[model samples]
Target: MIRLVAGYATAALTMLVLDGVWLTVATPRLYKPRIGELLADKPSLPPAVVFYFLYVAAIVVLAIQPALREGGWRRLLTHAVVFGLVAYATYDLTNQATLKTWSTTITLVDMAWGTLVTTAAASAGYAVMRWIGK
Candidate 1:
């Protein structure tokens, strides 16, 4: 129970930090020129809220916890990278296929960002759980 809670907390927090940096710092630099027009002029509150809540939970439960049980950081990171790739790929590919205005550049960049965020979060979660257990 402790491990589970710790892992979840760490993963969620790490994800939040990574996302905050990406959205606030990186977005203007990396994304604005590429997809500025597609972005909402004002932030959309509901979907952002929903996505973070669900995404962190899913990463903690599905990737971080499993990796903690099965092995060490390598396993956790592998799981995170694969999970991130698959999850983000689904979204990006779907958007590319259906959304007439979606940019391939954005899809590629987002996929990379998703992978990075999950990898960092999962690693942090696994490390935190190990430390707490010790």
Candidate 2:
């Protein structure tokens, strides 16, 4: 139980940090609103940061063990990548359409970053699992 909570929390924080980096350096010019803004606006939600974090963790939880248990790095990585992209793309497309901020360029950029970040976050969590288990 503790491990489960930690997994989600760790993922959320990871996403938040990555998001900060992206906002500060990746895409700062076009007024691209970030996770911070989203979360701040709604106290109920665990911030958009948590959304991404939970996303990363969820993917790893569902896909990682099965992949690692059954195959090799290729399988694990592939599962992570597919799940990450789907989550990222879904979030971006839904928000873009609703907010009327649709843009192919942005969509691709977000998807790319989301994929990379989600993979990184999940991998990081996996790396620290031993410590977390205790």
Candidate 3:
């Protein structure tokens, strides 16, 4: 239980910090919509574009830890589920982020992006562990 909780907490907090730096210093472009009206005001904004940026960042982080993804598919999948929980926890922190949102397609894409990322991270981490025989 402790490991599970810790894993999720770490992942969620990491994303929040990443989001902060991303919104504040690295890429102000990501946060432009944070202030706009949920739906009526940001039709020009593309959800895929937004999620793409986030997933790219997360993937970069995972890439830096190549050992994480060296494991077999079964082990990778298990860790991915935990990562999914973390991702969902992070997303849930602001359900309002989806309020007055755009079409279901956009939301589905975003969700898929999150799921893929979480799985990738788990696979990456598992690989790393297997490489190190940890």
Candidate 4:
């Protein structure tokens, strides 16, 4: 149970740091001009907070914990990537399908970024659990 909690913490922190950086730097650069003034300089805190909590929980529950239980780097990495792709694709593809202003470029980029970051976060969590167990 402690190991599971630690894994969750590790995944949450990893996602927060990496996703925060991407949103701060890459998102603005890639999206601002296309999105124009619609992109707020500061995101609203309530939704952001909710999203972070749910997102991290999903990662831990669906990917990190499962990978750890499966007990292999291959399983860890594969599940993380698949989870990321599915989650991001749901968001990006839905936006592309529904939003008038959404761009395919942004959709593709975000999906790729999601896969990369989630895998990294999950892998980091797995590593942390291993270290802790040792």
Q: For each candidate, what TM-score against the reference? A: 0.87, 0.65, 0.39, 0.91
Candidate 3 lDDT over residue span 20-77, tens digit each: 4543552233223442344343334587456645654453344323324454566446
Please list the residue runs of candidate 2 whose C-alpha ends up more than 4 Å from where it truly belongs after superposition.
1-13, 30-45, 49-53, 96-99, 130-134
lDDT value, residue 60 of candidate 4: 80
lDDT (tens digit, per residue) of candidate 4 on 33-127: 66655577777999988987888778788876676677678888888899899999999899889877888888899999999999988888888
Could you tally the backbone clashes for each prediction? 0, 0, 13, 0
Give the clashing residue pairs of candidate 1, or none: none
Query: Which parts of model 4 have CA positions greater than 4 angstroms off?
Result: none
* lDDT winner: 4
Whichever of 3 and 4 has more lDDT, that candidate is 4
Encode model 2's per-residue lDDT on 18-132: one tens digit a residue.
Answer: 8778856854453344433433332344565466655666765765555545764566667767887898799788878787446666678888887887776666555455356
Alpha carbon lDDT of residue 79, candidate 4? Answer: 84
Clash number for candidate 4: 0
Model 2 clash pairs are none
- State each model's CA lDDT, in order: 0.83, 0.64, 0.46, 0.84
**What is the Å distance of residue 19 in model 4 from its true position?**
1.1
lDDT of 1 by residue, 12-131 (tens): 888888888888986788668876777788888899888877887888877877776787777788888998988999999998899767778878988999999988888888888888
RMSD of 4: 1.6
Error of 2 at 46 (Å): 3.8
Q: Is candidate 2 or candidate 3 better by TM-score?
A: 2
